[model samples]
Target: MVGWVDRANSKRAHTLAQIPHEWIDPNVINEMKERGYVNTREYLDSVLPQNEVRITALTATELIERIRTRKLTSFEVCYAFCHRAALVHQILNCCMEIFFDDALNKARELDNHLVTTGKVLGPLHGLPFSLKDQVNLPGIDTTIGYISRVGHKAVKRSLLAKVLENAGAVFFVKTTVPTAMLASETVSSLHGRTLNALNLNFSSGGSSGGEGSLIGARGSPLGVGTDIGGSIRIPAAFQGLYGLRPSHGRIPYMDVTNSYEGQELIPSVIGPMGSSIQDLELFAKLVIDSESWNYDPQLVALPWREVPHVKKDKLRFGLMVSDKLVMPHPPVLRALMETCEALRRCGHEIVEWNFPHNKRMIDVGEQVYAADFYDEVQEILETTGEPISEYMKIARENISYKGHSGRALGVSQWWEISREIRSLKEQFLEYWEKTRDLTSDGKPIDAIICPAWPSAGFRDGDVEFGCENYTVPFNVLDYSCVVLPVTQVDSAKDIPDASHSPFSTEDKKIHEYYKPEMFSGMPVCVQVVCKRLEEEKALAIAAVIEGCLANVEKL
Candidate 1:
């Protein structure tokens, strides 16, 4: 049998070969290579046909309305996204699989249905949807960066996939992920590395990096991503996209392939990623409205709640500048502060808040995620003898408490850890409730604004350079979190402070990584979080913050 490396190469070659010749532009490839970093939006604007540009620019909501009104056909919408996605893959290496012909055909059928019947198909009719490699689609391989699983076809589709199809959504491509889905950066033996579309020098955050890159590049309006330890939010923050990580059981996780399938200490949840808050809400409401619990036993039967509109004058927000574990880099700190100021100027109340035992929370997350001592990752690597990617090695060294040879936790120790997690959750909720005394109206804070990461986006292979204390705490607490992009990295304005002291060794390393010249032009985003199972409130608050920022820009 041929070696796994050869198999991986063949798989990549096959994906590239599938792209039509007409879509392959030699000049674009040369331009991407000649310039180490090329912004996809500007590049595509200069080259793509006017019609394709206009079609792809429409938000999911706008596109659906147009299709319903018969101003634009489904074929036109799907074709535009497919063509742009093909280009995105060529430059960003984001897609692991592409089937534009299948997508186009599906679009044509939807258009025909619209013509024959006066009724609109569904809320997502004719929308072009992207998927993370972990999500299964029929007749496609959900390799998820594993070389051994490269050629194996998925016999069935994930529940989310079926739900989208039933709602008149068209699937065309699956984005890349890290090996075993364990790393923060998207790189693997199978698909190489998916780079940031905004700047090639930095990483597209992972394990949902592919989805982040594609959507950030405006190749797709909305996509699906999963998160355990900030997987979905990390990519969204780095790529300057809006993403929501709902509480566990809110969205169905059934029939999805994962690395550590049995671990429930910190259950992974799937949610939507998109360019706008409306897109995020639209996709999430559609899925919840479908009553996913009927199809997946794992889902909670919580229907999407329509959040009552809150006046900015009455809304209170908790501002967390530092998690006390690691202070964010200058750009992230500036973004947080600016967002707070904008909210305050809009008549919102801002209260300083801090949670207890953040470091211990990180410890709990690491132990739970690595509870099996990475045996699953080892077994998958051994199946094909594929070498671990450098980023994965970095992640293992930094996060894994025991060395590579350590044993799994015993049953008694596992139970103790579980109890500790339960206690921590209760304590966190109590603290949140206590905020009522600090707020202006004697009500708990509506949401908290914090840094999504220590930096906007880090250089490739610097995976262990920053602490995810901001995003991971919510995961452990099972609270609903949304990432909202606030600003881009500005070199002149976001310069490092020489007087800031590092909190720990990890903090020192992350501080050193924050050179203004290196991260200029990257997107800076903040995390907005609410109580557990409060997705509706979290999303509305995010929308409020987004609108406030837009008004600030107008000034």
Candidate 2:
């Protein structure tokens, strides 16, 4: 039998061979590998035809409008994205599956329907949509970067995929993910590592890194990613996109392949990633409008609600600079402070928020995430005799004891952990309620602004598991969180603080990783979090913040 590495290499070669020769640019490939970084958006602008570039840059809503007006046919929009996605695959290794022929055929059918009936198909008519490898599509294998799952085609489409397809989304490709979708970086024994489109040396941020990198590079305007612990938000933050990890019941998760399907203490939720806040809102509203609960009993029956328009002066925000577990690096700190200043100048009130028990919440969250000690992952690997990828090994180094498993807790112990999770949520709610006293308006803050991660983006395989202090707590509390890009890392302005003191060993390690030169061009984003299941309001508030920043930039 061939070794797993050889098989994995062969699989990657097959994927590369699928890209049409016309899209392959040897000069761009050599240039990207030589410089350790490449601005893909700029490179594509110079290489791709002017028409293709213009078509692919349009947002999802814009594409739908043009298709409806007969200004652009569905086939034209689909072909543009398919061509660009092929180039993205060659440069970044972000694609796991490509089916452009099928995509074009569907686009032609949509165009024929529109021309004959003179009626639009659906809200997302003719829009090119990408998916993470975990999302099941008919006649395609959702390997999700697992060598063992290779060649095992999905028998049916996942509920989310079906709904999106019904709503007129063209599925041309599925993006790469880390093995088991458990790591913060996108890599696997089967598909290899996915490089950041902005800087090849740094990570794209996973387990949804592929979606982030592709969208960031302008390959696709919209995509879907799942989050249990910051999977969606981290990738969006790293790539400077808008992502929402809605509370568990807001979106459907039926028939999705996952490592540990039984673990529901901190259940993973499906959400959307897009280039703009409007795209995010459209995705959530469309999915909710589908009434997914009818197909998946696990989903809540709540219909999409209208987002209340809160005036800038009426908005109250809590500013959390540090969680005391891991202080954000200077670039991330600057992004937070800059966002706060923009909001404050626009008449929003900002209050200091100190949440010391966030560390405890993260601890309980990890316990819930790894309750099975990765027995399921080992089982899958054993079936194909594939060695674990280096990224996954590094992610589990601190927790796993032996090669196959970690210490699994008993039922009673699991129950104890669940109770602790519930207790922490209650305590945090009380803390938020107490904030009513701190604000001048005498009400709890509408949302909190905090760092998405310690630094802008980490080098591949360098991400520590528990360092996501700001993001994981919301996941633990099942709160609605939106990641909004605020600024890019400016080396001169975001220099390290010389008088800073480390809070712990992890904090010291993170502080030492902050080299301004390494992260200079990467994006720095902040997370805006609201109470549980308040996705509509959270998205509206995020839009307000984004608008305020844009207005400030105009000055």
Candidate 3:
């Protein structure tokens, strides 16, 4: 009686047989499946080695400053990012659970406690962090892409994986997610579509699409994902990396696992992705220096607060180009107007945001996220008749098939959709405090510049229009955004706008699912945001607009 397609092909062959057979290469994965396996960092620079691709291109604060100065050895940066996350999860099926001998026996006990106490057991000392299959890792199996949560084992361990294993890091792997991580597009019948570690025919943006295709293919350098709407900034803006969505209680979702598992009306926090923006503020400053709200009493003792620099031509951002409902495409609106006119020619002050509370916070966040209508994941897929994934039956036929299963929403209609989500967060904090009389020096505009997804990645069933018109009104105004990775998909400078105009029918299915040379080189992100608990001023305005998006995408 085993067939949820034989338990999703034995949970994807026990996650590529936990990847350690000397990092398999069946002839460089059969010559990139005969020349069609579109680059996962050139198939991990043709199968790792070269010092495991320079220790998986170090960056979890450069593998914790060369493993705290002894020139690297937390068992050589956790056996070179667990052998480049076991050869990029044996070809971008971006890992779900691969222990690598339990992260090389916890990086040889943090290299025997930093060679017997020469110090460094905390600030992520051994560095190798990755986790998104909904965090939890007692004995593994956070089957978030649930075939009724196969083999089920997370008995304990998930308070952000025991605060990044009590901050000396090194967790090997655990990435992919979609099923009950509830779709952005990480596909699943257990793990069939994680791809795009840089254009494997586009889309590695999920429910933290396997920590954005394993740290956008450097395979684990910094990881932690979960974003309510933009699942950790649409897989770190579809694998160009540098994510974070922190706000709801400022990081710490307690014992994790969520597919609306107790949907706190747009909750889901936990942040960080990769390709360093200083390891996305070193994984939100080691989970706010583990004052993790005095051990997760639903976090917010809010420390690690150092966001004081503001002189990049006296800040003032606000931009929001087009949430007039999905317009961006043309290399994601030319990487947001060439990184907002190169951060206004390296002086900043962009203004124009006006966000009249995005259609009543998307009409009270789609009736308080479908008022518990996902019926405990369709009653655990009709009591385990399981096997579900045409991208979750196209997200239950694009949400209109909600025939009320476990039926929720009636504590006086969920307290009147929680007073219309607290009056759309007080009309989005009175339109972000009246954008300080339209900024320039007014303060109410240090961050906003939008577009996390209009088009930069999409292909696999394109999850039937789901990036909720630009990262779900900051997950219904819990704000504190951050997506970064500014430019790509240029097809000789991203064209497509044969004089257009649509704004509906999902903006003409995103302008016929855009095609400047068919998403030429993918990755083109943006989203800074801020406010609500302002994650260190939205990652310090995405590290100064990624240092002026590398000299404005070289013009």
Mind giving the per-residue lDDT tens digits that candidate 3 earns over 1-555?
786878888888887887767677756645776877677776676656787688777677877888788887888777777777777777778887888787788788888888898998898878888888777877778888878788888887778778778888888878888788777788776677877787766678788888888888887788888887778888788788888788889788888877766668678888887886777887787778878788789887968878667534468877887877668887877777888888888987787886766766765675666676566777787666865556555544545543423356678888887888888788777887788898766777767888888888787565665556788778887888888877778787777888878867778877877877877877788888888887887787788887777776676
Root-mean-square deviation (CA) per prediction? 1.6, 2.1, 21.9
**Least accurate stretch of 10 residues (summed lDDT) in model 1?**
398-407
lDDT of each: 0.86, 0.85, 0.77
Q: TM-score ranking from best to worst?
A: 1, 2, 3
Collision pairs in model 2: none
Per-residue alpha-carbon lDDT of candidate 1 for residues 281-302, written as tens digits (9 for 90 to 100)? 9988888999989878878899
The model with the greater TM-score, 1 or 2, is 1
Clashing residue pair totals per candidate (backbone < 3 A)? 0, 0, 0
| Candidate 2 residue-wise lDDT, 10-113, digit = tens | 77877777677777675777875565437776677677899999998888878888999999999999999989988888888899988888899999999998
lDDT of 2 at 282: 92
Best by lDDT: 1
Regarding TM-score, does 1 or 3 come out ahead?
A: 1
Candidate 1 Cα RMSD after full superposition onto the native fold (Å): 1.6
